[model samples]
Target: MNPLHRVGLATARHPWRTIAAWILVLVALGGLAATLGGELRDNWNVPDTRAQHGVDQLREHFPDAGGSSAQVVLHDDARLDAAVVDEVVAELEGSEHVTTVTPRLSEDGDTALLYVRYDVPTTDTDIYGIVDPLWEAAEPAEEAGYQVELGGELPGTATEIEGRGELIGILVALALLVIAFGSVVAAGLPIAVAVGGLVAGSSGVMLLAGLMDVSTSAPTIATMVGLGVGIDYALLIVTRHVARLRAGDTPVEAAARATATAGRSVVGAGLTVLVSLMGLRLAGLPTYDAFGFATAISVVCVMAAALTLVPALCALAGRRLMPRKVRRLDTSSPSGSDYSTTERGSSTTDDTWTARWVATVARKPVAWALVALTVLLALGAPALGMRTWPQDGGSDPKDSTTRAAYDLITDEFGPGANGPITLVADLDEVSPGEVEALHREVADLDEVASSTPVSTSPDGRLAVWDIEPTTSPIDEDTTVFLDELRADVLPDGVEATGYTPILGDISELLQERLWLVVGFVVLVSIVLLTVMFRSIVVPLKAAAMNLLSIAAAYGVLTLVFQHGWGSALLGVDHAIPVSSWVPILMFAVLFGLSMDYEVFLLSAVRDDWLDTGDAKGSVVRGIASTGRVISVAAAIMVAVFLGFATESAVVVKMLGVGLAVAVALDATVVRMILVPATMTLLGKWNWWLPGRSSAARQLDDELDVTPTPTH
Candidate 1:
């Protein structure tokens, strides 16, 4: 017996024992997570970069300037009560986390702003928890008829958005499963297995989190990918088991065969996904590495469940997995009756629609291929102009305090007042006169809206200047201005170390390293596909197909999020630059997911080609066999991704929309249409590997005309 089948048989023979062991492990892991899980921090530690170097220098010489700062904005139609202003300032200055507080009054005295500096980085998980004191201090202002709104790191780190997105996604997926598989028992089994896998996977991530810097979003992202693939993998195995049983095999035999066939495909597909995800490590970014590890763990757990747990459940349910009426009909129907091969929970076995569709596509392979290629190119065109930046409070909800503070500041002062770029210099390494001269040059530049007087550290070894740009934080002009300062205006020893410049530096780093990451992902995928399909042409073609679909997804994001095309439909109020990390993360995830359909469809097609020695017929038959399951699985994934699109965070929405679009295009155009059309045109060349014999080529001429059973 095959290894996959042996595992399935052993689990099937002792379902209770297997299930009980899994439950015990889950409980133990959950307890460990509750007590020992480490805190997740958004530490953007991109090494070997100018931004990090500047940060290090600031921390060493000017700790006050290097620490994170929060803004407290107070506005009143009349002059702000002087005593109330002092009270808030005193409250902030009295906090243990606060290192310093500086107050600024607007020209009319109607608005007051306080810049409060903290000892820790704004992204530290500790910051979010210790903000209650500041909120308590602001209550006096609110009671005195003065509107108080907090901005900057204060509001950004205050509270993380909590949503029921995953739960809602699961509910939607279950509905689609019932519609596809008709039998409540059969549909429920996949859901149960998927949820179990998710629990195990999430627990593993928690255990790992206890030792490393996992982002708070890691669990949600892991859950998102795990649930969709878990259900889909289990569905494939269960679908195969039902077909084998209907063919008159005993329960144990049917489970074993299903595990051998679909189970193998599941393992192969899961491994491809894992390889693509693990390729993120090549980017040299810890954030991507954490993402790769968490998601990879989830994929492994689900694949394991599909091999063992799914088979165990199938054996226990036996023929009763179907509705009683449908079971009786399927068992009693004659050989020619439709019920002999399919009933409830097995509607996909009827390949009439898929077969006819493939036949139509085969007649005009060239035309269909060009049509899909053109659509993909058109959708991806906008990506040429895509811009990236860090999202700020300007994109926050209109009613939120952060947005209000940002608006008030922009209305009264310049837009750059919300995020002034700081200039830090070590005067001990250079003359104070030269530092002043550099400051004068910066203040005289055309891009300068205003500049604060240069201030020195307590020992006078360090000098700092806050320079406001003429444009907003997200404006391209701010980046251009920083470039000018670095190239010509600033002295050799002076450096820029503010949030705006640091963010700009990180963005540039990502842009520079983007190609390297892409190369790593494509190379890994090619090697994996070449070995799996046993054909050089198939791997190259798979790479091209995945790239095209991913390009199309990028175009969709550029149009919808960057160009404000249909932005209102997705809860976005205005156009904003794409997040810097979106492209790389999306590429890794989309490439892995795209390969899933490729592996499943080609695995079945290759099997048929070997058995029948007919290239064109095998192409058509392969699509007919796997099209329904792939379509259903893709639909479930799309729903899961789009559910996250409804989230409040802009970054999460971008990821959700991009993944949903990519999966949809891959399933319909790439898998159903392009793969068959291209294979038909390629003929025997599709399967050619090096050192093939003439006898193998000659066998393609002999066709097997026997019709394949739909199951």
Candidate 2:
């Protein structure tokens, strides 16, 4: 027996022991994670870039300059501004986390901005704890008829937007399952397996956090992947087990067969997803690596549960796992044979909608292929115009303090002041004349709105200059200014560091390594598909189709988010560049998900082809048999991903909408329309091999004969 079947049989024979062991593991891991897990934080490093070099220098030589800063905005009548701002400053100075607070007044004297510097980075979890004092201090200003808003990374990090997305997604998946299976037990089994796996998987990530630097977003992304794939994997096994029981196998036998058959597909789909996620390591970014590894853990947990826990449930539940009507349909067939085989034998123009659809496609395969290809190409065209950058305070929720502060800064100061590039210079190696000349050169740049005079460090070895741009932090013009500073304007000893330059470097690095990562993921997928489908053409077609689906998703993101085509519908009122990491991460995820459907559909087709030598018949039969399950799985995944679109973070929203669109497109357009039509065109050639068929070689060797085979 194969490994998958072996696992199922072992679990079936000792269901209680298996169930107990999983439960014990979940409890132990949960306890360990809660007690010992390390804190998760955001990674802002763009390695080997000028910004990074500057950061390193600042940390080593000028540690105070590297500390995080926040803005406290107090708007009141002209008379109270100066006094109230001073009082607030005094109130903030008492906190140990507060290093300095400096106040600046607007020209009209109606506003006061207190620049609060902290000894730690804004992402430090401890900073969040200290923010409560700042808020309490601002309360007196609010009572004094002044509007006080705390803005910047620290305040934004503290804005806790409660997420009901997973709960809603689970509810939706549960409803769909009920409708599809027509039995509560069958529908609930997948959910049970999914939840158990998610709990364990999430705990595993928490434990992983203790060992490495994991992103705060890692848990959410892992949950999204875990629930979507876990439920789907369980659904596949459950669906097959139900069908087997209906075909007259006892519960133990049916569960074993389901585990051996559909169980193999689950392993294939899960491994593809795991491999695809693992490819994120090649991106050379910590955020991707953290999320990737965490998500892979979830997929592994769910897949194991589907193989072991799910089968154990089936064996314990017996025939009652299926609804009365479904059992009737299975046993009452005229030939008393399984519906799976009976449906295959039915006419091409049968009552089943999938079979009828396949018949229509078979009649005009080329035309259908053309139509599907054109639609995907058209939808994907907008990706050509996509621009990637990091999101700024402007993309924060409108009601957030960070957004309010961002607006105030943009109004009182130039937009560039919101993200001024910091220029660091080693004065020991430079002369006063060079510093003067550097200021002049920066001031002359077209994108620069203003440049601060150089201030020497206490040791007189380092000097710093703040250059504000004419555009917002994430603006394309900001990148232009950064490029000019790095390539044309900066002196040999000077380096630029700030949000604009840092994000610019990250964008450049992502673009440079994009193809390398894409090639690696595609190559791995090709190998995996070739092994699973046992055909070279199958892998090539599957790869092309998955890429097409991912392209379509990228186009949707570009059109909706980048161009603001339907931003208001999604609650985003302004157009923004897509986040630099979204596309790379989306491609990895979408490619894996698309492969999921490919594995399910193609595996069924291969099985049918092996059963009957008629290629055309197998194509229609396989699609018809697996089509409904594929649709249901895709729908579940779409619903789960779309639920996350409600997230406040722009990057999360991008992932949610993109994944949803890709799954929807892959299921309908790629799987249903393009797959059958293209296979029909290829005919028997779909199974062709370069060398002699393995079966033919084995037969010749067994007969102890060497006969030349002719094509």
Candidate 3:
């Protein structure tokens, strides 16, 4: 019996139950989405340690100092007049949100920059909400001849966040699916599955965020990744079912077999993906940890939908889903071949490349293993010097408006002009002498080019300072300096608060937690693989090989994107430090994707082995039978990732390229070449483990089905 036929039969046995459960799940997810309605903030809000400490220092040193302010650029040239400035300042001060307003002149003498200080911290969501009204109030200033432009990080980030990337991502996904699947209905199926998965995944992320301090970036990551993997997995199963139906199985039979075989493959693959993502929790960075957890949840949901909901839909659609003409086509043999002898018996019985490859492996397993091992080692060499840095502060791609603005700032001012570090401090019982001493200490620091004391709270509990660093804020050295200040400079007398300080602390914490995250992932991978294969040796081999492949991929990324060795050829500028999020994100995504091929290939091999009890023949036949489908699926996935690289964002580009490279490598080198060679080398040992005889027999019984001999 074909796997699709088995799937159809199984589904038929309890159609109502499957349908009812899916409907309930969908309804619950839909309700959650409706209620959440985009209310969640897009990124995590990490408070700034430096800014807090700076604020404290200022309050203790300069009691009369006002609060930190944002310089709003107004368009009207006439607002430069004293009368207009005075009127605008009075109105701003009168506003409930604005604590003080001071107008300053640009060197050009024609523009006025209003320094408006709000009573609340800049991270406060209410400050963002009030911006529109503030803009409205400033409109009269514009009417009086001033143009208003908000220029702070919070305002800029808020605006960008409002321009949600969801719609674009959806359109891209739909278009790709339609083109790849070549049917509106087929494309829609994957989209539907992805939507459900995304909704569920998003809800999971929200719940997690409510419990822990998670980066706002995690949800967007979950949505993007869930959709990509969901659609890819669905395409694999649906296409296989369609092929099976064309092979002359009835709709119900096709659904059953497809689900049983492809469904099983998906389950195994999904587990691999989930486990791989879970590995990211070992990264110890909150951003990566949250990302790993969120993505793992999404992958699980998507897998569930693909294995169950998809099969149910196929069962319901029956023959109607395939066009009448497609259903009528003969599919008893290979679609366009005339080798009668080759087509007879089980699909794996024929002499094929897989057979030839298996014969070679059997004859010279040692030689093949050596060759594969050498190639992997050589490829992974570049990873030794991998550098991790934030990709956010670099110049945007040349064509982007943000990049243009960034360039204007950098060229007119300097490299560090684009991103300034905010230093904040908490003030309690610190004396004025201590406060002044701290200020002078900061001013005299080698990295600190300049410092401006901004405000002192009326209660003298807080003060803020803006520090201009000699290097770009994103520079490693600058980050190091920030770390030193947080760890060594500040004592019980003052507390620092700001994004830079928080980032430094997080970086150090991530370094300490790195090994734990790695250990956790490896342990999980071992357990999951062991359970799935019921063979300790096989799981160990698979994990070792996967680690090698990942190392090679990272090496390539480091060489091209980090060291700037070939970035120009790849159409990117100077490489920034690989974002702190990249390793965990890449590990999870690559691991999951790699597992897709692993399960697909391994399942076929296991099936052939069960039927013939000839290990070599089974390995060859399995590889040959699934290789074409795996290649096509991998190609499509790579295309999707590569398309994402076209975006101007550097982090997104790195992610796209890295993932695409890993998938391609996994599909070809790892899956096709290394896996078979390594398994052949292991020989009978691949199934070595205590109690394995019974487990192997059980797996064989569960997966085994009567092969339909093509005559």
Please tell me which predicted candidate would have the highest lDDT against the true structure. Answer: 2
lDDT computed for candidate 2: 0.81
CA lDDT, every model vs. true structure: 0.80, 0.81, 0.63
Give one digit per residue, the lDDT tens place, for model 2 in 168-217.
78999999999887888888889999999998998989888888878888
TM-score of each: 0.94, 0.94, 0.78
Local accuracy of candidate 3 as per-residue lDDT tens digits, 314-429: 76666555655555765455433322123212334432665666567767777877787788788789888776765443434554433443444444345454455655455665
What TM-score would you give candidate 3 relative to the actual structure?
0.78
State how far residue 86 of model 1 sits from its true place (Å).
1.2
- Estimate the Cα RMSD of every predicted model relative to the unseen true structure: 3.5, 3.9, 5.8
Arranged by lDDT with the best first, the candidates are 2, 1, 3
Q: Candidate 1: list runs displaced more than 4 Å.
A: 330-349, 691-711
Candidate 1: worst-modelled 10 consecutive residues by lDDT = 701-710
